[model samples]
Target: MLSKVITIAQQKGGTGKTTLAVHLALAFVKYHNLKVVIIDTDPQGSLGKWFMVRSKKNSLNKNLTFKTASLWGAQYESKTFKKDHDIIIIDTPPKIESDARPSIEAADLVLIPMTPSHVDFWATEAIIEIAKKAQKKVLVQINRANQRSKLINKTHEYINSIKVSATNIIIGNRQIYPSSMGEGKTAVEKQKKSKAVEEIKKLSEQILLELK
Candidate 1:
């Protein structure tokens, strides 16, 4: 079966882009029992670092694998990994430059993770336009969100003002993400009762539907 490519991307840095990628990869591996492959295209190598840490521990899934590559090599890896894995998640760079384009173009779906702020909200236009130009679909995911906050509600209004589609789930601001990632574990394993785990699982449900 051809693997579904989901590229988590954002033009601005620190929008929980890598967090979303890591959580989703873990969820797919632990919950869905799918063989997932992660391609880290970020120059900072954060995703690869996380995978390395996870590698130190006993991996939950023997079939799940991760590797790093430049944007130039991502296209080849995207095509190559699908033959052996059920899904391929590419963590692209934090810009819309050539480094991010290759992964976005190879994506079956590009996830735009943005925090609720004027700068973060507005930055979506560039990446959205880039995805559109690539003739690919874009899905928005609200990251570092708090549902009860006025800013969160206002951000909802902001999203409504835009014409793009987004996931119904909200990834609330929580410490479990960073803490769990540090130990190479996901929210599901580290903070089982926390809302953060629910948010990740909920987002993946919508993502799974979109992939179908």
Candidate 2:
């Protein structure tokens, strides 16, 4: 199958972009049984570090591939990966405004993760505009949020006001997400039957529909 590129982007830091990318990559590989390649375009190199840990633990997974590149380089690299992989995920650095276009343009979908805070709301529009200008599909992912917070309502309002699609499943502020990543495993791989695993599974299903 030809690969579909999904670029996880956020203009602000601490939005869990790297974590989301790795989780989604693993979900596609394990649950969907797809060949996945994740490209780390962020200079922070967090994704590469996680992949290294996973490699040592699993002796390098055959279904999952990890690579690094610049934002511009990712556009070219994702195209080449499409020949064999079923999914290509690019994790980008924070605060990359206009420089984010090459990566966004390469994506079949641009996923923007935001917490239910006013600060994250403020930081989201610039990247949304960039994705809009690039004529790419954009999905706002609500991450690390408390389910009962009133802010969740406001977040949906904000997404509607901005006129972008969002996933119906919100990634909760679950400990399993970060703790598993720290051990080079996903919730699906670590706990197997936890809420975090279910959230990722549903989110991955939603993303696959969007890609189709």
Candidate 3:
């Protein structure tokens, strides 16, 4: 089994950090048949709330596990989870700055999600530097994006200048993402064939390859 810890982090709020965490967790389970555990380090408890909804709906999957921990505590918890789970995803609160180090250090890869905007690009640097300083591999995820927008090219240029790898598969700005979460299901589970599902599957495949 491939045991890896991925920390989804962003210094700015509303970057879809929690959303990415749950989707990736479910995608790994549903599509890759991997044992996945998601640790909610965000005090807002969005991930925990989503899990609660899933449990109430009796829709919980055996391959998926949910836990709560502080960002600092995630490092220790992930080590313990690594023994049994194929992947441990740490969902962190935004604006954590230096406090994000422990989680970053725990991860084999730090997955930073950002929108294709100058504001998001500016906010991404701190987390990226923290991850790079820890000598951990980093993958930047462009989330909730409009692929046709002119800003898309500018986003690529910024990423290139920073010399960090960004995913080829960009997660589009879709209502299905938030709507599916409301039902405690991912887009992949809520719909069999859709653009959202396609993006997630391709992303999971790419991430799994990077982990190997």
lDDT of each: 0.83, 0.92, 0.94
Give the candidate order by descending lDDT. Answer: 3, 2, 1
Q: Candidate 2 on 1-212: residue-level lDDT in tens?
A: 95899999999999989989988988998889999999999898988888888888974476998999999999999999999999999999999999999999999999999999999999999999999988999999999999999999999999999999899999999988889888887788887688898999999999999999
Clashing pairs in 1: none
Which ten contiguous residues of candidate 2 have the minimum total lDDT?
53-62
Q: How much is 162 displaced in model 1, in angstroms?
A: 3.0
- How much is the lDDT of residue 151 in candidate 1? 83
Tell me which of candidates 1 and 2 scores higher on lDDT: 2
lDDT of 3 by residue, 47-119 (tens): 9999999999999688999999998999999999999899999999999999999999999999999899999
Residue 26, model 2: lDDT of: 84
Compare the candidates by TM-score and give the number of the best one.
Answer: 3
On a 0 to 1 TM-score scale, where does candidate 3 land against the true structure?
Answer: 0.99
Rank order (by TM-score, best first): 3, 2, 1
**Cα RMSD (angstroms) for every candidate in the order listed:** 1.5, 1.0, 0.7
**Deviation from native of the Cα of residue 123 in model 3, angstroms:** 0.6
Among these predictions, the greatest lDDT belongs to 3
Over 4 Å off, model 1: none
